[model samples]
Target chain A: MGSSETFENELTQLLPRLRRFAFSLSRNGADADDLAQATIERALRSRGQWEPGSRLDSWLYRIMRNLWIDTARARGRKEKHEAPEEEAQFVGEDPRESMDASLELKRAMAAMNRLPDEQREIVALILVEGFGYREVSEMLDLPIGTVSSRLVRGRTALLEMLGGSADG
Target chain B: MVEEEKFFAWLDGELSPDEAARVEAAVAADPELSKMAAEHRSMAAGLRGAFGAVEAQPVPERLQAMLKGDGKVASLTDARSRRQARLAQPFWVQAAALAATLAIGVFAGSQLGGGQGSPIHPRDGKLVAAAGLEQALSTQLASAPANTGPRIGLTYRDTSGAICRTFEDRAASGLACREGGDWRIRSLFQGAEGQAADYRMASGGDPQLMEAVDASIDGEPFDAAQEKAAMERGWR
Candidate 1:
C-alpha cells in the first residue's frame, strides 16, 4: 500500500482511541473533535517523518498535544473574564443510576478543571487516557523522572480537591 | 531490605521478585507498613478505574464533528485569524483589544455552540449521538459489566421524568443523576481500604439493549412527554 493508504489505514484503527483521548483533554466535545481533526491532518501531512516501528498512538498523541497547546496559546490571547454560559438544550440526566453518580462526577470534573494546565494534561494523558508513564514522558517531551514526579504532585492535588487525604 | 521507593514500585507491580518478597515480608510483620501498602493499592485501583471510564463512555456527536476535517479546520483558522488581528495593536491597545476580542470570541463561540451537523448518520437511521455527546449514552450504561467497578452509584430514568441514582464506582467515584440522561457529579472520595472488584460496562445483545434505552421511557422525560405519552397510549 502507498504511504497515504498506510497512514489512512493506521489512522482508521486509532480513531476511536484518539477521539477518546482528545475528549478527555478538552472536556468540551467540539474542542476535542477539532483537536483530533487537526492532529490527524498534521499526522497525515507528516507521515513521512513518522519513524517506522514507533507506536502510532503515541505519535498521534504528540501531534494532538502540540495542536492543543497551539490552540490554547491562541485562545489564551483572548481569555475572557467571565465564565462561559452553559448551553441550553436537552439536559436530561440518566435516571437509571442513583442520584449520587451525577453529583460525584460533577464534583470531580470541577476539581479537575481547577488543576494547572500542565498538571491537568498529565493527569488526562496518564489517568484518563491510560497512557503509560514512558509514553506520557515521550508524548509531553519530558524526562521519565519529571513525568513521575509531576504525576505524584498532580495526583496529590487531585486528591485534596476531591476532599480526600492526600497522603495515600 | 525494602526502601520507601519500593512501595510505589511494588504497588505499580514493577518490583523485582526479590524486592517484592522483601516488601511482602515487611508488610506481614508490620501493621503500619501493611496499612500504607493496602491504601496505595486501593488508591491506584480507584484512579485506574475512574480514568478508564472516560474512554469507555461513547464520544459525543459534537466531538465527532470537530474531528471531521471541515469543522476543525474552519474553527482553528477562525481562532488563528482572530489572534493575529489582536497582535497588530500596540501594547496598551493590545490590552483593550484582548478584552474586546475575548468578548467577541465568547459571543461567537457560544453562538457556534452545540452540534451543528446533522444528528442522523446516513449509514444508521438512529439519531447519531452528535450534539450533547457522540457515542450512544445508553450503550455505556447497558454495556457496563457486573462486578466491574465499585458501585458508587446507579442511574435510570425513573417514573417521574427524573433520572436518579446513588453509589460509587470501585475507584471511589461518587456521582448523582437528576433528569434522565443529565448527570451531576457529587463527591469524589478516595480511601486507603480497598475492598471491591472494578466496575465494568454492561454487555449483552448490543443492538437490542441500545434500542430499549432509547425507546423505553419509564416516565415522561421532560420534553419528550408528548412522545412518551403517545407511546404509552399506543402510538400507531
Candidate 2:
C-alpha cells in the first residue's frame, strides 16, 4: 500500500478508540467527535513525521492531545463538560445493582471531569483506554512517577466522590 | 501515601510482581483497605462506562466526509475560508474535486476489506458458526494449545452479557459472542497476518483486532481462572 493509503486505512481502524479517547478528553459527545475528526486531519497531514513501525495510535493520540491543548489555550480555560442534572444516565449501570450504585457512577463521572487536565488524560488513557502507565507516561511526555501520582490522585478522587466506604 | 500510589498503580497493572505482592498483602490485611481496592476496581468500571461507549457509537457522517475531503482535509478552523476558496473555483474544478473525493472513498473502502466473510454463514436465513469453532471457543486459551485449528483469545462479556471470544484462522479474523447453543459472529475482518491477536495489540502490535474486541467487552477480559471456569460450563 502507498504510505497515505496505509495511513488512512489505519486511521479507520483506530476511529473507535480515537473517538473514545476524545470523548474522555473533551468530556462531551459533540466536542469529542469534533476533536476526533480534527485529530484525523492532523495525523494525515503530519503522517510523514511519524516514525515507521512505531505505534500509530500513539502518534495519533499525541496529535489529538496537542490539538486539544491548543483549543483549550485558545479558549483561555478548560471547559467543564459534566452537567449536574444528567447524573442518572449511565447506560452501564445495572438497575438492580443498587440505587446509590448508579448515583456513584454518576458522581465518578462528574469527579473525573473535576480532575486537572493532565490527571484526567492519565485517567482516560489508563482507565478508559486500558493502556499502561508507562505508555501513558511516554504519550504525555511525563515522568513515570508523575503519571502514577496523577493516577493515584485521580483514583482517590473518583472513589471518594463515589462515596465508597473506605476512601483514604 | 507511597503504598497508596502503588496500590492504585497496581490497578493499572504497572507494578512489578514484588510490588504488586506488597499491595496485595496490605489490602488483605485490612478490610478497609480491601474495600478501597474493590472501589478502585469499580472506578475503572465506571470510567469505561462513562467514555468507552463512544467507540460503539457510529462515527458521524460529516466527519467521515471531511476526513476524506482533502489531503489536509481543510483545517476545522478554516472551514469557512476554505469554502470561500472553493466558491472561487470554476464549476469544473469543483465537480472534479467531488469526483476525486468519491473515487478515493471507494478505493479506501475496498482497501479496508472489512467485509471478507468467515466460515460462519447463513443457512435458512440464519447465521451459524463454523462446525468445530464452538468447541475451540470454550477450550482454547489465548496463548496455548498451539495447533493447526482456529485459536481463541481474550474472552469477555459484552454489555448485554454475551460471552464473546476472538478467533482467527488463515482466511478470517473476528469476534464471536456465545448465544444460546451457538456462537454468533459479531464483527469480522480478514487478512493473512490477521492471526495477530489482541495480545500483540496491547503489548505493541497492529490494533485492528484489539480495537474490535474493545468495542465488545463490557469490562476487563477474563483472567485465567475465569477463562477456565467459563469454558468448563460451555460458555453458559
Candidate 3:
C-alpha cells in the first residue's frame, strides 16, 4: 500500500482513542465530534509535516489541542449571546450512553468539567489519556513541574467533589 | 508537602524506580498516605470510565468514510488525479459506468417502494423526483422539523444557475437540481438510511453525491437565513 494509505489506516485505528480524547477535552459529544472532524481534516492537509516514525497520536492530539484553544477563544467571544441556545441544543444531542452512565462516572465527568481549562487539560492528558508528565509537558509546551502541579490540583478538586457526594 | 508531591508522582508511575520504592514504603507504613493513593487511583479509574465509553460506541460512519477517501477532506490532488483518470476513459465506458450507478439507485429505490410510491422514477432516461421526494424538494426547507418526510440537507444554486438541494429519505440520498420545475437527479447513492441525521449532511458521506455537489455548487450553501429566503422565493 502507498504511504498515505498506510497513514490513513494508522489514523483510522486511532479514531476511537481520538474521539475519547476529544470528549475528555470538550465535555460534550457533538463538540467532540466536530473537534475530531476538524482535526482529521487538518491532519490530512498537513500530513507531510508529520515525521512518520514519531507518535502520530501525540501529533494529532497537539493539533486538536491547538484547534480547541482557537475554537474556545472564538466561542468565548460569542458565548454571551450564544451560550443559552447552544447549551440547550447540546443537551438535546447528549449521547444516550451518558444517560446510562454510572453515577460515579457521571459525577467524575461533571467534576472534571468544573475544572479550569488548564487543569482539566492537564488532568485529561496525564490521568485520563495515560500520557506521561514529560509527554504532556511537551504537548502543552509547559514545564514538567507545571503539568504535575496542575494535575495534582485537578485530581484533588475532582476527589473533593466526588468525596462530598459519595459520603453524603 | 514535598512528600505529598512524591506520593502523587509515585501513583502516576512518573518517579524513578528508587523514588517509587521509597514512596511505596511510605504508603505501606502510613494509612493516611495509602488512603490518599487509593482515592487518586479511584478517581483516575472513574475518569477513564466516564470518557472511555465513547471509544466503545460505533465510530460514526462519516469518520470511517473520511479515512477511506470518500469525504471532502480527501486531498485535492487525489480528487484531481481521479478526475483525470475518469476523463482518460472513453465516452462509452463512462456512459456505461453512469448507467450501472443509476441502475443501483433504481434498484434501491424499488426496494424502498417501487412504482408510484417510489421517491424516484426514471423518466425519459433521467431520474426525476417523484412521490414524497418531489413534495419534499418542492416544499420542505432544510430548516423544517427533521422528523417529517425525506430530510432536505443543503440548498444551493448550481453552476448552471439552477437551484439544487440534497435530500435523504429512508434508503437513499442524492443530489437533485431544479430543472424546468422538476428536481432532476444528478447523482444518487444507496445506504445512508440508518445514519444519524446530523451525520448524513455533515459528512456528505456518499462520495459520488458529494462530487456532484462539488462540481455544481456555485459558492457557499444556503445558510438558515438563505435557505428560508430561497424557500420564500419558491427556490427560484
Predicted structure with the largest lDDT when compared to the true one: 3
> lDDT tens string, model 2, B53-90?
56776665645654463322112223322233333322
Candidate 3 TM-score restricted to chain A: 0.85
Q: Write the per-residue lDDT of candidate 3 for residues B1-236, one digit (tens) a residue.
A: 23666778999998999888887987888887878887778767867776777777677665676688632222323233334434332233234335446766466556446656778877777778888889888888765635767878677898889889887766667788887778898877664432122222233334455566778888766767777787788778
Specify the poorest-scoring 10-residue window by lDDT in model 2 chain A. A78-87
Taking the tens digit of each residue's C-alpha lDDT, what string does model 1 give over A25-103? 6534334445666676577558888887788888888888777766554444534442332221111122211232234
* Models sorted by TM-score, best on top: 3, 2, 1
Error of 3 at A19 (Å): 0.6
Alpha-carbon deviation at B116 in model 1, angstroms: 41
Tell me each candidate's TM-score.
0.47, 0.51, 0.59
Residue pairs clashing, model 3: none
Put the candidates in lDDT order, highest first.
3, 2, 1
lDDT of 1 at A139: 80
Q: In order, what DockQ does each candidate have?
A: 0.06, 0.16, 0.17
User: Between candidates 1 and 3, which one is better according to DockQ?
Assistant: 3
Best by TM-score, which number? 3
